[model samples]
Target: MHLISYITSRSQISEKSIQNTIELLNEDCTIPFISRYRKEKTGNLDEIEIGQIVQLKEQFEALEKRKVSVLKILEEQNVLTSDLKQKIDKTDDLTTLEDIYLPYKKKRKTKAETARKNGLEPLAKMIMSQRINDLDYTASKYTSNEVESSEKALEGARFIIAEWINERTDIRNNIRYQLERFATISTKIIKSKKEDEKAQKFKDYFDWSENLSRIPSHRLLAILRAESEDFIRVKIEIDNERALQKMEDRIIRSQNKCAEQIELAVADAYKRLLYPSLSNEALSIAKEKADEAAIGVFTKNLQQLLLGAPLGEKRILAIDPGFRSGCKIVCLNEQGDLLHNETIFPHPPQNRDTDAIKKISSLSDAYKIEAIAIGNGTASRETEQLIKRIHFKNEIEVFVVSEAGASIYSASKIARDEFPDYDVTVRGSVSIGRRLADPLAELVKIDAKSIGVGQYQHDVDQSKLKKSLDATVEHCVNKVGVNINTASASLLSYVSGIGPKLAENIVTYRNENGSFSDRKTIKKVARLGGKAFEQSAGFLRIKNGDNPLDDSAVHPEQYPLVKKIAKDVGKNISDLIGNSSELKQIDLNKYITDTVGLPTLKDIISELEKPGLDPRKKAKAFSFNQNIKSITDLHEGQLLPGIVNNITNFGCFVDVGIKESGLVHVSNLANTFVKDVNEHVALHQQVIVKVLEIDVNRKRIQLSMNYK
Candidate 1:
């Protein structure tokens, strides 16, 4: 139990607590709720901490059960000894335990085991001593019908001892670690193989090996994966003479023959036993490192995608573009207050909209929309035209907003908060309008996966993808604290400890109860434990609360110290905290303590300067040429300004004027030296591109980043 605690770095986990959490997990007690509402029992651990503990506990229990099963198997074979029992009972890591039991482990024929069966175990043990290196003298004593010649005698002896040497897990572990220290990984082009036309994809890994430690994580994973697919092969056996010398120095110096035999045996064992077993281990290490690097890029992409600045403080008439179901139109007032919503099928029924005109005129007159946000989904162009026909001129600006994740948010708790009576489809339209107004705030409600930032996203490992994206979202959400007064359950879920289910529960509780006066209300939510509240409360802000710092990220645990800080500033806690100049005067060193390090203290000071501030970059406004409304409006040799929507190996897509967007082929990227698209263009980048060709028939427009 102490070992488990030390390994996991937890003081203790009572059986009762484990059973309780397991039962709650079985009963669907959401982590935030279980962590927040059920605080007393969990020792104040937060949702993430509790989740990790659960995972560790599960693994620990499984290992314990496995130990019993292994012992039972050995007992059944009547081979369980007190010494073996002690080793098994004492061991923790599965690999090391398996190593310790290898000598007694059952297996098919091996060279050493075959020689042992051939009555040459004694001879093998003798040769391993290396005390008499004459070869003939050593072999003559063990000579028999089974040991036909000196070569046969030595070979059989070496094989038997090697197996025994490998059975010692300690020696094998030491040698493995040593080899890892000395191992190098390198890559080389298979000179003969690269000539084949079929090897284009694997040409990068033709022949590569490097210092195992220095190999870039992603490159290593790629090589290993290539090898698994039979595009290449990898190996990690130790250098023979160097390894032999090291073993001789480490083994011969020891006095005991059995011990010396074990040492020499370990070297032989490394080649025959440990080498085969660790191939998969090396491959896994490579993949894990690769996944980490890939996830970092994925994390950055997710954060930027979510943190896209919102147009904030705009009255928008959002359109969900469609053909079969027509378009869903939702209007929002200056405050994101939905004024009216209606569906219009202006395209299919006819290019004109007598009914839509009436509805739009009435909704427009009633709501007085300041701008129009059109979803860049199916039928967007037609919808844009439909909306344009009845334009009120300067009163509104039409903007095409990416409707990615709008559907996800619509069915989310945040959406439900604004439109309790509206359906999911209607809520989706509202989300699109709100997104154009305040993208970062609205996107926080939707899962990052739905934001559409990857290549072949659906084909990758979904759970792994979700975990990485979720972590990124959490980091962003915490970085930009949510306004508890206005935040929906959807956005709240991304705030560190809060998850989707818990966020919904928080909102539900708020709806059933009332708006939160302070974060303390979190304690009232069903099943919420202390840990959940501790992690989430600081990040979830209430605009005007009893403790003004509640509107900032200063946790309740640090409130008393904050009050002391206020005293030092010669003002009440509320007055001094949010005043930037006043906060600047107060020394942070005065507030420092053992519990709060400089990193955390600095963060607190920053929060005080801008309470409940949205940390995302501000949105930039752009205008398209009034003359260009559709792809047909484009003319060859005409230049236009655009933002790079996405870059791929083949070309870069620029959102010039039309919703369809135009592609700038790799050839058109620059006049010289373009190896990778990433080096030239990136997602959401602004660049000046010239129209090269427009094939109106195919709806393909060629554009170029080539000079003016």
Candidate 2:
């Protein structure tokens, strides 16, 4: 199939747009760069549209490659025909291509191959033709020393007929239709492991049954996980009689004894060959859908978490709260540099509250701290209460930060490189402080899966998950342009064209020389070629730089256009920066060129309006109900404040200032029927939930948002 036309049909994108996107991708342009910079070329397609085009293009190319391999194999076997070659060349679907190649595909020794070796091919053909009146005589004619008897000859003929029926494209398609529409997935408990302690967690799926087409992605993943763990036996079923009847209708033409033999062959084909292969295919397709849905959810959650409000360059005193180990404390400067570090046991076995208060107060006073970030881990509630009771020298805003992947970041080599002399505790404490200051920058150092924001992360396809998460991080990083001087290597790596090596090189250059004064100096970095600069320069910002436009989202190549626009307005570039009145007066139509269109001109105008502005909001302090400490303290009908920490298809998990986060089921999200969990809530959204139920033994708290 034609690659561009196939992609257009699949993505519903214009042919021209798909063609342009493919060309740009072939030229090594990234999705973000092509979408943002080449809008005129792609007809103003956004990142998502461009991403679809890229995925579909890759799929089509893979299909074409497979067709070439299959054609070569067919030619080598001396079985290729003009019509067969045309069919394979015209088909774009992988399944259809495989179906066409099935009869020619080489296989291991089977009943059909063995029967053919025993000289039963002519007898099988006679049985398939259904014109013979005396089947026993025809079968007897084929009997030999290898066949032994007419009965064995008949059996061998049926086996060859069964293989032919299995290879027929129309018969296979009929069975696939039955499976796609009517398949039901059911599971039964493995009796031996029903009472196993580890198996109890998957008890819900032990005896579950659902239509495969309508089963929720999360539910299917859970069931599959249970089966993988040997806790349950899963089966995919459909109307077998209906499938066989359709196959028989397509193959048997006469009502003679020959037809009877063909019927037996159809039954054998349905049972021994077709059902097993197609049932597995049906399950595999369902699993691919489930994986896609799960990966999409993860991508959205990671995006929200990464784009979460930043506490932007504040002097922070962060605490990684603990009980027996004492809370590790680290003081961070506005640039997220570690200035001081210590430990404070404000709670339990070493209940040195007074000394802890003294040390905290002195540290706050000495570091000129503007905020206090308490980790929402062990003893987090008590720590927050303790910090609130202290009379600080300054009016410090206390915030409770989620410490999801702080430990992972602490033990990582990235952390070791950042702080070579510090222990894990100190590194973890520093991570907490850095996260509070800039969540996206610090969170980038840790893997997205370790951030505790996704559902069934480990159970999905790891390669697809990594690709999606990496793409999300790259989009968010480019969405909010990176600071050339202040950004960490982890954060810089996600910028448009800068991978890990280039990021390290940029950092080393920054360390050896002074900070970058303009975007042009980025070319001086080793191994950063012109193409990399073209893709990355627009996303890297230099604050207090030589040129005012360098800090904006406008690309370096567009500098002359921006200067020309500024000159046309009779104002200098600095005077025109952030001067919306002057920008709006100029007619954007006047500057349209062959390479520069209204889209690029409009984007430049908008960037000039809010030059170097962060798309994310500033972080604010949140307070949990002081009276509620743990799950036991929660009572039905009591209202409490909470933050949405994780979301799934079923519901969102809300942290209610307790050890156990509460579940607000999708039904309870609102009085109306909620189709999507994200429609009513988002990651890190603060809301008040009414406690509906509590199970202290299981440590479960049920909450409801449908309150007056």
Candidate 3:
């Protein structure tokens, strides 16, 4: 099939754009690179549109591969006809192609095959024709040593007819339609596990029923999880009588005895073959859709969390809070190198409040700490209060950073390689400090799934989730632009065309030699070929380097064009950088050429206006309600300040300075009907929520964003 036209018919993109995108993709250009650098060729497609094209192109390739395999199988069976070849060639849908190949698939010993082996094929065909009035006589003629009697022969004929009906593409499609539109999924609590403590979390789904097509993705995933856990038994149901009647109407054409036989065969097919197969197919389709939706939610959340505000280069005092084991403290320099590490017992058992306060004050003063980042875990609120009590010489901004994946990162091989002598607690504290300085730089070290920003993340398809999250990291990293001089290997790995090996090589080269002085120096890294440099040079920045444009998002290939524009505007390239007024006044039309169009020129102008500027906002300190330290402190109607820590399709989970995060259901997200949870709030957004309910025993808190 013509892939460009096929993708165009499926998406809103033009054929030329799709063709160009596919060609670029085939040339090993990344989505971020293609969307950012090849805008003119792709009709100015953004990352989302470019991502859609990539997904569709992969889908087309997968379909074509499957078609080739199917065609080969058919040719090998020696039953391949010209009409069949034409049908296979004309269809692009994988399901339609499978339906065409179903009849020719090799099967094991089954009742139908057994019936054919028993010499009942003629009787089956006669019954299917619906023209024979003497079906009994025909069945008797078919009786032989294998068939004991005419009744037995008729039974075998019915089985063969059932297989025939099941194999009909139109009949299967009709059943599939019924299942897709009318199927109801129901669940029942397993009697033995009804009272199990582990099953209480899924009690809502114990006796639930919902239309399969209408069930929300989260809800379906929950039910499927419950079923997998053995806490409930789930079944897909449709109107049996209606489905049977539809099949009978489609297959039966006459009122003869042959028609009666066809009716029996239809019932058997519906019960034994068609309904079971089509219902499972429908469920699988639903599962795939649900996985896509869940993965989308995760991708968006990860993007927001990764691109969350950065505190910039500042001395930071980070604390990983705990109760009995004491809080692990680490002081980091402006570049996030661990300068000092210690432990302070501020809460319970060994409540060295005075010593803890004294030690923290001295560390802040000694390290010239500009900010403090406390882990939002055990004893977090207490630590914040402790810090508030101490009066430092300098004004230190205190941020309660989310510690979702700090432990995972602390215990990782990457962490061990970075800090060989430091323990996990010290490593975790360093991560918290680094996260405060630049979240994108530190969070890339941990797996996105372990970061804990998604809903039902582990339940979805792992491979697809990893691909999407990896792409998101790549997008965010490229969008903000990486500092080539100081960026860690983890951060550099996500740069376009630079995987882990190349990133390590760059870092190793920097360690042996000095830092990169200009973008040209990057080409000297071992194994970094011309294509790698072409794709990665734009995203990698060199601050205070030999050339000013080296730190900007403008690709090195366009440096000559930028120089011409600068000369035309009667200014040096350095003077032209960040001179928005002068850059905006330059006529872009004069610079358009065969390869460089107006879009590229406009982008160059914009980048020059803000060279090496971070796309993320500056970090700000957030305050939770001082009085609310734990779940018991919460009361109905009490308005408390919280941060949107996690978001799902239903609503967002808000951290209200307590161990338990409160849920704000979609209905409570706003005064109007909330179609999408993201429309009302975003991850890391600070808002005041009113407590709607609190289940102390269950440690569940329900909150509402509609405080008014």
Candidate 4:
């Protein structure tokens, strides 16, 4: 029951590392902070390893709490023997603990309980003992007003024995193991719902069977979802004969009359009690594993989407495209503040291309727009085409940004607070433009699940999904290093250790006292104490600050060390900032104190080399086939340029400038065998794909990358 011991047994990480991570987490240190700052304490564990330790710690705490409740229950029932208590105390797993407590748990009215109430316990005990000499007489003696005949008494006794056999820890554990190892999960279409159109999407799973242990996460989740919708029936099957034989071998000791009775009880136990429980338990465990895998995929995709190429502080004209309603357009300044807004109809019901082109050209010249961001939604391709045809005064780069969660952000409370006077359309247009300018800053305002970068996202554990996505956002934000003076409260909140309250307070402090010129001013924010400042100072950047290190990833605590290095080298801190030649002259070993190791020193030197450098790539203009505007325009074997919009365990979905995205299955990702989809494709990655098939009836387009 020791927490560290249990965690060490389950994870390959060292016990000391886990212990240190647990202590840091208990002290309210965040995963990013500990992973970045407390490397010496955690043996240089990354954020993922630290996160695993945190999850395991919570799991062990839950197990211990359950154990305490079980002990109290056993004590009140007068069955808490010293040996039993010791066994329960020694067990660490929840399943094993529950198994030990099963026999002592109170139950409602059942055949076994009724027989026990009628005083058939001794006959049940005789059958369990496998003594045949007086088994019939013992059963007959138990026949009372409730039990009329010896056969009836024996039947009741066998029922009691059946319950006893089911409660045996060895029998339950063995059956659970067999189920986990060899169970086959099969699905069938509900006969009544076979003609249901809604069920056709899951048609691939209508007659599917796969080993439960080997089923991939995406397929398993799909089957389970289909079962949940009642369009399909799912079952977990194992060899019943083998399971029964195993049960008999575990319980039957000899071939006597009592043994024969026990054999009958074992059959009832396997068929009625043990099989169902084990099947459900095994499936539940498998489903949890599948959930974890799906969540991992979701977190990775969210991270990639958030960190996608940034166009960086440009004057952008963003458009939310439409056909029936005119395209909603907004011009954003370099800081993403809305400067102008209007609507233009260049398509459909009223084709006002001339006026639209004139207005767009005038606006681009007036606002000095550098890039054009068009939403990849309805009429997007048409909008891009119309914009291209415009004879603008200046050369403007056009980029089609994914509008997956733009509506969600527009209708959010955050959006309302940021733009109380603006409607959803204006806010949505602003979001599209800001996404092209800086994706991480704008995307953090929306819920990660609504971003449409995941598979089975809504079907997984929501709380777990949120936790993982939040951690990923934090990692990305800290890795990129937020600008303290200009970052929104939403972006600030994800920086290493700053929560919502502190972020709000920091923004308020900035509003009252003007922009932060140095890292020390952050401590002056209301309710932001020493610990918060320590964890957050490194990730918050202050451009053109009094201290040059404020804009870099180097922690403020290391400022003194850098100063010493500067003094030792006979140069000012500013002189050594970007002077790589001078930085190379000083030995790093000399700066490595007991508190700071070579790793921290090396990172400090690297940061000093390129202070405040952005890690994200620059956004570039991508074009779909000019001739292809919708699914109707697609043809088999036609090579087209597309962006990878979503990735899953099975494959990646590519946007080919159509209403329906084309699927490039994992097998089609490369000419050779592709094992991992992420290895070959990423979110927002531009690539050329060939149309393999287009199903107009289902609106599904299959694409391949193997075409020349």
Number of backbone collisions per candidate, in order? 29, 0, 0, 0
User: What TM-score, computed on C-alpha atoms, does each candidate reach?
Assistant: 0.63, 0.98, 0.99, 0.98
For model 2, name the residue pairs that clash. Answer: none
Reference-based lDDT, each prediction:
0.70, 0.92, 0.92, 0.91
- Per-residue lDDT tens digits for candidate 1, residues 1-708, read 433452345425565565566666665555544554455455455656666665566566777777888898899889999998998887766676677666667888788777887777777756555555455666667767777876686667777777765565555666666556766655555556666666656667887667775676546666655565556667664566665555556556545544445565656766667666664465456555666555555555566666766676877888898876878998898667777887887777454467887777677767777778888788776667666778573467777777878888888766786788999879998888888887767776776767765533443456777876776676667767777667766677777566778887887888788878887887888767886776677778886776687787677887887778777667887677668887777677766565565555666678788777776665565555556777888888887888776554456778875766798988999898787666787666678888888877556789999865
Q: How many clashing residue pairs are found in candidate 2?
A: 0
Per-residue alpha-carbon lDDT of model 2 for 110-154, expressed as tens digits?
999999999999999988888899889888998888999999999
Q: What residue runs in model 2 are displaced by over 4 Å at the alpha carbon?
A: none
Candidate 3 residue runs with Cα over 4 Å from true position: none
Candidate 1 residue spans exceeding 4 A from truth: 1-120, 130-276, 322-326, 333-365, 378-390, 393-397, 405-430, 438-447, 454-467, 496-502, 519-523, 527-534, 544-550, 554-609, 623-708
Cα RMSD for predicted model 2? 1.2
**Model 3, range 1-708, lDDT digits (tens) per residue?**
778877988999988899899999999999889988998899999999999998888888888999899999999999889999999988989999998998888988889999999999888998888888777887889888899899999889999999989989988888888888999999999999998999999989989999999999999999999999999998999999988888888888899988887888888888898888888899999998899999999998999999999999999999999989999999999999999999999899999999999999999999899999999988999999999999999999999999989999989999999999989999999999999999999999999998989889988999999999999999999999999889889999999999999999999999999999999999999999999999999999999999999989999999999999988989999999988899889999999888899889998998999888888998999988889888999899998889999999989999999999999999899999998888889899999999999999878999998768
- How far residue 447's Cα lies from its native spot in candidate 4, in Å, is 0.8
lDDT ranking, best first: 3, 2, 4, 1
lDDT of 4 by residue, 1-708 (tens): 688998898898998898888899888888888988888788889988988888888898999999999999999999999999999889888888998998888888889999989888888987888866877777788888999989989899989999998899998988888888899999999999998999988989989999999999999999999999999999999998998898898878888888888888888888888888889998898889999999999988999988899999899999999988999999999999999999999898999988999999999999999999999988899999999898777789999999989999999999999999999999999999999999999999999989999889988989988988998999999999999999999999998779898999989999999999999989999999998998899999999999999999999988999999999999999989999898877799987777898778888889998998999899999988889877898889898999999999889999988889999998888889888889898899999999999998789999998775
RMSD of each: 9.1, 1.2, 1.0, 1.3
